[model samples]
Target: MFSKEKIILAYTVEKCKKCNLERKRKYQEGDLLFAETSKCDSCDGIAVIEKIFGETIEK
Candidate 1:
């Protein structure tokens, strides 16, 4: 018997250059690359959308 199972998950990456902080979270609507996001938690820095990608995992 053969079975195939896989799941794909999307994610968004945000980074702050001032603090060199990086964050990853689930993908959301209206998210665009290089777009300015919320303030950083570590310091008074602005976080920007760095990248958006997806990964596949076996179930």
Candidate 2:
């Protein structure tokens, strides 16, 4: 029988080109790859979207 077993969660990864700072957060609307985002907390650099992916969680 077919049944639901796992939950897939989507995430977005952002990084700063100048400082190499990386961060992962939940996916949101209008998120596109290579898009410039907020400023980096560790340095004076702009964060850009690096990758977008999903992971399955066992229930």
Candidate 3:
């Protein structure tokens, strides 16, 4: 029997892709930053210290 193999890749969180817009925004320890998504607006976002991505490969 062959079991399924789980694969995970490392990830990192940076500011929004836009500099002009990001300039006005700021990030604290718990500020959510939404990535560049077509469905999201300029403010559509999550915290910078996200729990899901907080457990990456320890950078």
Candidate 2: tens digits of C-alpha lDDT, residues 1-59: 77769999999999999999999999998999999989998997999999999999976
Over 1-59, each residue of candidate 3 has an lDDT whose tens digit, in order, gives: 87566555434344443332322332344444454422213565422322224322322
The local distance difference test score of model 3 is: 0.36
Model 1, span 1-59: residue lDDT tens: 87769899999999997897999999999999999989999997999999999999987
Can you tell me which runs of candidate 1 are displaced by over 4 Å? none
Give the candidate number with the greatest lDDT: 2
Give the Cα lDDT of each candidate. 0.94, 0.95, 0.36
Q: Which candidate would rank higher by TM-score, 2 or 3? A: 2
Runs in model 3 deviating more than 4 A are 16-59
What are the C-alpha RMSDs, in order, of all predicted structures?
Answer: 1.2, 1.6, 10.9
- TM-scores vs. true structure, each candidate: 0.88, 0.88, 0.25
- lDDT rank order: 2, 1, 3
